[model samples]
Target: MTGQGSHPRHGLVDVIHAPVRLSIVAALAGLEKAEFRFLRDTIEVSDSLLSKHLTTLEAAGYVQIVKAGTGRRPRTWVSLTPAGRTAFDAYTESLKKIIDAGN
Candidate 1:
């Protein structure tokens, strides 16, 4: 058994554990890709906050990013990579396991 105060962990994913990132992954999982504004609005976070989380997920290889300019405006799009999908699936399973353990 783990020491007191140390929580039992099985397949928990730390990166996606953050509420915003989890939402980001969940939103992207259902779509091929999503625009920055769409994700920002869907996640209900400020632009900077969304960008920060994207950067973190991108660094972790959980998301793919592409930037382009439409007319005079630059647009950013993000999608879950194959790795991201796998990680998200694992995260879901882990969360389920945690919940089931308490039952």
Candidate 2:
């Protein structure tokens, strides 16, 4: 695992180390909060994949899931915690720096 300080040019390399997880985080970063289905559709991933990524993020304490009963169906909503937002912002900044360095 890469430490945040190891890659001065990419502080978020650790957070987005997995491509799928990276995409998941990126997608979540764009929304204030989103439904599970919405995230799955936006990311174009299967239920298993989305669930796996969400589990990972949840375990990392980067995301929060809210379960609510909506009539006959149950709705699951996901949102980034403050820690997640900070991590995502740092990751984006690192990516920008890397791109700038390459240019």
Mind giving the per-residue lDDT tens digits that candidate 1 earns over 3-88?
Answer: 43334355667999999999999999999999999999998999999999999999999999999999899999999999999999
Number of backbone collisions per candidate = 0, 0
- Evaluated with lDDT, which candidate comes out highest? 1
- lDDT against the true structure, per candidate, is 0.91, 0.83
User: Ten consecutive residues with minimal summed lDDT in candidate 2?
Assistant: 1-10
Scored against the true structure, residue 58 in model 1 reaches a CA lDDT of: 99
Give the C-alpha miss distance for residue 99 in model 2, angstroms: 0.9
Q: Give the lowest summed-lDDT range of ten residues in model 1.
A: 1-10
> Which residue runs of candidate 2 sit more than 4 Å off their true CA positions?
1-10
